[model samples]
Target: MWRCPLGLLLLLSLAGHVALGAKQGRVRRELAPGLHLRGIRDAGGRYCQEQDLCCRGRADDCALPYLGAICYCDLFCNRTVSDCCPDFWDFCLGVPPPFPPIQGCMHGGRIYPVLGTYWDNCNRCWQAGNHSAFWGMTLDEGIRYRLGTIRPSSLVMNMHEIYTVLNPGEVLPTAFEASEKWPNLIHEPLDQGNCAGSWAFSTAAVASDRVSIHSLGHMTPVLSPQNLLSCDTHQQQGCRGGRLDGAWWFLRRRGVVSDHCYPFSGRERDEAGPAPPCMMHSRAMGRGKRQATARCPNSHVNNNDIYQVTPVYRLGSNDKEIMKELMENGPVQALMEVHEDFFLYKGGIYSHTPVSLGRPERYRRHGTHSVKITGWGEETLPDGRTLKYWTAANSWGPAWGERGHFRIVRGVNECDIESFVLGVWGRVGMEDMGHH
Candidate 1:
């Protein structure tokens, strides 16, 4: 006959009573009420193993008093509302536990139940429900929430013809940067924040550069994307998302005041909310020009003169033509398919990686984005591969990739960036030149 130590037997009986209390919807009674006891091993250490008191069947007496609660030693304990001691399976059943201890996943000092998720910027993360794994946002969710450029309608895409042609004999430079070529003329990259108004930001950036260059640096104004986001409401959705064609149309027809007059308010509102109300208005001048009728939105700045651009013209998908146009004029606007990995870009020539190929389709997602194609260059890899890239300015601010710029693999229509490239001339004239 096997007999247990008197103290050990008492603990076993107490553990059984605690388990019974738990099963009967009552608070588990404990001698040490203030002790912490959720983990596999408690402060006392190795209760079931040291006692060697595992029961062979569903024996009522087979239980262990853990730190402050009860854990069972019989097989029946694991069937429902598992209260088995950490070592019950190993010592009693001669097998490892089916799963690791049921401690919830910990993040930022908070415990999240299995399958709980949280978003970190554009990426979403979740705890593994049953396995020791983590997952991120689905591709569909990434496209829906993180990206905002709308695919152009066939009518809008074909409206403009290629506006520039390459000279057969004239040589094109191997590298070019708008900021370097025309110092102080190219506007610094601006942060769009979480707003999906790249349509407005890119259009405004390209217009700003072209206006300054066309005016010979005399009228270097940072044009307002907010003007476009709020006022260009005919066929646009403001920060929610918009089309470049519509944005350009608004810039040409109505015109926008400089950034000083109407500052950006897109960052202050919810990404899903409507853009701030149209704060600035304009009246048509005698010619195809207009004048702002409202005072500057920012009280400190008084200048409210409207800036306009010639109708935007598209460029052929040929890289040389795009480069030639950029060098001769200024930065041009281009549409691109932004993939999940694009958000993580830090630097270097970027090409869409196929890392998500084997993963589920939910993990592979992309959305259209508009950017300013500022320059172009070629990088020769150690393996003697020449990787041509476009130096594009993103609206994500100067802190992001390459000082607010990113180099993407050029030519081969990477990310459809070259598919629908566009350029425009600032509507600068003698009157505008005289004032500046």
Candidate 2:
């Protein structure tokens, strides 16, 4: 959903106005980042009469049409995913003066300014089908594309909570290691696509991170996207892949078994027989595609898709710089392939899924990633409205979110740090409980 960032034309226009003291009417407070700002008050006058910015992104007025404000989000700024979409960033591209917004604007490893509708790099292309498809999707689309609103309702309380988000095809790697001090400090094991269990995966990953912090007497659970897609404990599909509570129960009695050391298939259903004759490392399309609601196909292909190397260490003076700037800036961005199911979540947990206009199998690499920012927002939008936090771009997908993009809510969750989706919810929890 990192498709369209702030319009480039709008960014340039804002910068120019700020520099030139152009005039605008009924000026609002500071401009909302990632918004298209124009016709604002300048030092010389209340409003600038000349069209300072280009018209390449020329669509109908973006701000409320009749408001006659200097700026407005385009028609594509506030619609929902009712039907299939073609392509949405063409409006700004076709125009000459002001450029159109483009998708994947920030993926190629570059941090862009919060410009308005500026199309460049991987963002340039024909936007006919896309533009009209999102005729009124700027607002919601941005939220969908920017914010990774997906989540699970349940929570876990242990480091063993890891391992639920793998796909149905994989098994726990025998090479997996446990805490050196606590031999029984097992990680959670899970199934695939059963519980819409991103929370489980999150728990696992965070547990790992917290494990590193275990010496401090603390543990933080995280969702695991990998296990959800790979574990395959259940027959269901989508981002909601595994369960943490179930994982807890699985290990409660049995301790923890290796993915291959055990011979059981899946506890969910639709299995050919016993577990596919493969290990978590086997890659046999384990547990089917449960836990695969978020679309992040081929993301791991690029090492930079998830984990990123930091230039500064958090334990040193440079660490302060990281906390102040880099943490909020995040580490990476890209498109994750996921199922269309995520669309159901809007402005909430697992709400990042967007309507794919193409065949489901086609956008296998369509998930969005974000920068781990510590804090941001309370700024204005393109149409003179204000909101907190600007959703960073990811290759994932888009929704009718803020500024026609998805965003990361800074300073709220663990989003400020680099996040790796470990695995999703699986059926182990349900199976151990004797219910599905």
Q: Top model by TM-score, which number?
A: 1
Error of 1 at 106 (Å): 26
lDDT of each: 0.71, 0.27
Q: Which pairs clash inside model 1?
A: none
Give lDDT tens digits, candidate 2, residues 207-283. Answer: 33333233232222223344333443443232323343333332221122222233222333333334332122221
- Please provide, for model 1 over 275-303, each residue's C-alpha lDDT reduced to its tens digit, 9 standing for 90 to 100: 58999998899789999999999999999
Question: Residue 195 in candidate 2 has what lDDT?
Answer: 24
Supply the TM-score for candidate 1: 0.68
Q: How many pairs collide in each candidate, listed in order?
A: 0, 174
